[model samples]
Target chain A: MNTTSKTCLLLEDYLDGQLSKPDKDSFTAHLAECDACREQVRVSEKVRELFNQHPQTGLSDDADLRVRMALRREQYGKEPAKDVMNLEETAAWLGVTPGALAERLDEIPAFEIGGRIRFSRKRLEKWIEMKDGDILLQLQQSHLRKDNNLLQFPGGKHGKQQSGNSGAV
Target chain B: MTFSDEELMVMFAAGTMAAFDMLYERYRHRLFRFARSCLISVSAAEDAVQDVFMRVIRSATQYRPGYSFKSWVFQIAANCIRDIGRVERKMICRNSHNDTSGLEIDDRSFHVRRIVAANELDQYLKVLEPDERMLLILREYEGLKTETLADITGTSPGNIRVRLHRIRQKLAAGRSAVDREGEI
Candidate 1:
């Protein structure tokens, strides 16, 4: 069916209603003789219908209201003075489950206000710095371990020099 | 008479809240649907739509004339969702595999079952490259024109058509990416 033909390429445009009248006419004529193109267009139409028919389940009615309220806050409320965050937002920001965050309560500087766990942004920034320090330390330790491993290898620097001198000979 | 999207954007930039409202009405549902395709949860998609509109409101003055407002907002949406994907580690949080708890012995139920196969929808999206899937969603569901798509992706309209053609070919072939790779 010459799926790679120029006419077949136009089939996408035809299905998308992007073709001009004359081009559409010619493509329709060509479709009469092309089962592959016909089937391709049919499947694509079905796919388009499938996508248009539903919306990945459905959005709640408050979805729009929430967005509008957020936009209003952005437009009118100015920036939020977010010095503190609740448990869920903090856990989400830390990229961990709330239960996991709870496990690390001693490690983190968290407090409770109105009997709910809260995290200070400043303390979290300090925590991030500590995490970065630990990561850098681990990386340095790994590099040192690699160097020591190289030193203990049978063909280390001394053997390499000897091999180089022999290769020169 | 309806104002053009560009005009409405310019008006909003000039501090016309009504114009911003007009733009919101135009895009709220459409953008949510687009975000829903790439995100894991309905709430996440709703959050993404909010993020997109907030960015638009905050940066309205930066929108210049001759720039397609549709493309500009969609570009922001793409970036916003991609960042969220990174933060969330992009999990596939499906309710269940083959969950048909609400079916009935009727034509309407039959159609609902056929149409609302979320797993099948996931497979359809999973086979394509992420960028290809984004382009398809923007084209078909968001109903962006080829020109605006080209503007969003910074390519020529002809190139956009070619890309969409290739994507269509992939869909019609119904071959998994692994199968296509094995061909090579």
Candidate 2:
């Protein structure tokens, strides 16, 4: 079959009973004359059945708790404060000097409980990933792309930049 | 009355923690399963899903009304997985190659072996590229409509359909290869 026919055959709407009645009728007629497309549809249906047969593995309770706790931290700017750790211990777990951590303490996500500060391992890991070098590079590249796009499309709603004072000669 | 996913997202954007919780509860399992199926690593999947939720939290204010919340969420997840791939450069986790123990098939009968071979679903899927894996899982496992899959992956529906078809052929071939290996 041609590429267009192959792509058309992959449309799940006909096999899935999702197409409009008229569209479905046309598709059914088309399928009746096409053995290769029929086999393609059959295999796709089998793939769906195979997927349905497997049980969905869920997050463990601990993982769920960690996610919830992390959300709570994001929501409140700090968690309700459980398993509070001292600054040194937190730094130790993070493999950083307490002094270095202190310098960037505000950058780290932390919680204050009982007039003492602490950190959750989950939050710390997130904080680390947020500061991760790879993530930083990705963000940098994204910003660079956005900047390039902006530069390319100068003078949309943002008004054109006056290059060399536009007739200043 | 329980709110719909979109309603919950509106509430979540308004800083309603309960709405966020409800949304998480509703999608966590399916999202985790999709991520796990795509990444084939339990920890990586969990991290990817967590990052997806975090991005949703961060981008709540930018959400528009026209899009389906389900599609939006899965799009965030697809983007997250892609970003993970770009950063890590290694799509599958190291352990994915090592977890072949459970994939062994019996030499019983060809029919039985075919059934057992089919059961090694993950192994079969591993042959496809990351995008292909995402397309297959989203369509077959998550039962997402073609339009929504297109929206999530930012591809034309026709292209997504073609990719899904290609993935199906690849998976079938992978399974057949496994069956041949078993025969030997």
Candidate 3:
């Protein structure tokens, strides 16, 4: 083929903006002179316009949440969240007796599948997160009451404390 | 600090759900657009995108930081769409032979009118094989580089460029042309 025909064949890459700078410049120079190639470029640009106008459908507002949930389910299902635990397992995870846990079942987040109470490790985690702060606060206050030093001694009375926890502290 | 897709992917492998979430947020819409364009049916396209993410997390541990994560997930989506297309094609074959009425959901004509009646390219896309259609979508619409398209499609860049040229020629032949003497 002649040079013009060869350049005409580069129309796809030219319109795609894939050509290197010099090649693009040459193609641009060629487009100015070549009628067939310019017309082809116009049609290709129209094709591009069609692509631009394709109207991407159904990426609804919840698509992220939807796919996210789907991925979560897949990940959880594959990894086995081991998150949902039976009453006995949940009690074991919580370091409580099953009987003790049953007393607090109403307070804990749980669901009954087939009449068997199960707890989500996720919900349990959040529950622990909420209550652990209070538990920690209570423990800190109890320690503070014993020491009476947290306020009195801005610097902790580390040496004055002769408790068994002296080494731990 | 903002992380690259590859960085986020590596972080995701290290068990950061936020990294995965970031990856999801970046890709969900783009993947949906590609899937919707090629798969035609909205539900199938959505399922394909969901399937892509599922595969992403499932294989996130295997993702290397050296590769482009965009290419990685798109390859997964492309494979997912191809798999769905294969099953649908078989059903279409059976449905065609049996003249089945109930399975028309997968019918190209029905879906063309329902979902893509207005997109002029969709008609031309109908004539393309799935791979060619995907290649065109990735290259032209998605603005993926020839090398990235190569990586996603598992072909050489030269092969991609050649295919793109041929596909464009086919599309131009199929589309109404600009007049030789007049402006577009």
Candidate 4:
């Protein structure tokens, strides 16, 4: 009996002992008659054995300690803020509605303390570092300026006009 | 009798140093071997296993019950190996020059054959990507179930099964390709 490509892939799983008993029996029955699949299974088993025989390699003592220390520091670094500001206060600060501020919570990392969710002051400060606006609009403006510069003709002598119009910042 | 992995982890979480030590002993060799296969560097593998143990120590307090400790530890080791692979991508390049010819094997003929087999297998394993190698290590070496693999990898069990199937196919192809090249 001829086997499809999917069935052949299934045969690989069967040989790996990953198939259920019924599937295994079916696969074995098929393997009993199928020369190509049997060969594939043979090759797969040898590969598994070869992989098992390979020895393990390890990292250095110092570096291992460093990574562990780093992870621990990350986990225990910041104490959850106790006096979390209410949604109204946060929305007022951002100049957005409480619903809009709530939507942005997914973008900003926060932790819960005493059933009240709170954002780290440091994290909020970092968020403030970025210029605010639709990101695509900023990207489009930058792209247009770059194109206008590259497309400028030699000795067009429109320097004052270009600078006056382009110097929006 | 030895405690199960779950029991050991629970004990470790409760700050039992002995339980942590026993868990380390139980899985140290296996974890070392798993990392070594993924990173293909002895020092890197050692470092990865140590990092995993340290993470285990620090996160013992955060360990949730009803999860497989083996999968958790193996995932940590896998992540460490990935970081090493990213940093040392050039250093860990596979070549016959840096192959297992350095292992000192002065024993009987059978022992020598086993060592050679091991060496060949290591060279073959260097072909797989780090993620593929980790999956193979978890399933083949650690004997983890699909559910455990899913939890560790953060993928659905069905996806893990499919990925495992593909990984086995890739390894099988790698082995056969080496055999065809007369490298076996």
Q: List DockQ for all candidates.
A: 0.12, 0.15, 0.17, 0.09
Candidate 2 wrong stretches, greater than 4 Å? A1-10, A20-29, A78-169, B85-119, B172-184
How many clashes in each candidate?
0, 0, 0, 14
Error of 2 at B119 (Å): 6.7
TM-scores of the candidates are 0.62, 0.62, 0.64, 0.57
Q: Candidate 1 residues A44-161, lDDT tens each?
A: 6766777755434444444554454456556644535357765434543543333345555777789876666678978888877978756334432332222222221112222343
Q: Rate the local accuracy (lDDT) of all candidates.
A: 0.66, 0.64, 0.65, 0.59
Model 3 C-alpha lDDT per residue in residues B1-184, reported as the tens digit of each score: 7789999899879976556766776787888888877764566677888888888888988898889998899899999999987776665553222232322245576655544434446555655788888887787788788788889888897787667767766766655443332353
Give candidate 4 regions above 4 Å deviation: A1-24, A33-40, A52-169, B97-115, B172-184
Q: Write down the lDDT that model 4 would get.
A: 0.59
Question: TM-score: which candidate is best?
Answer: 3
Can you write out model 2's per-residue Cα lDDT over A1-169, one digit (the tens) per residue?
A: 4334643653587766778878777777777777556656776776776666554547755455455445544654433433445554454344333334455567777887665667777776676677774533343233212222222111112213421221121
Per-model i-RMS: 19.9, 12.2, 11.4, 19.6
Q: How do all the candidates rank in terms of DockQ, highest first?
A: 3, 2, 1, 4
TM-scores of chain A, one for each prediction: 0.38, 0.39, 0.40, 0.35
What DockQ class does candidate 4 belong to?
A: incorrect
What are the runs in model 1 whose C-alpha is more than 4 Å off?
A1-6, A33-36, A53-59, A79-169, B89-115, B175-184
Q: What is the DockQ (computed on Cα atoms) for candidate 3?
A: 0.17
Over 4 Å off, model 3: A1-13, A16-23, A32-40, A80-169, B92-119, B176-184
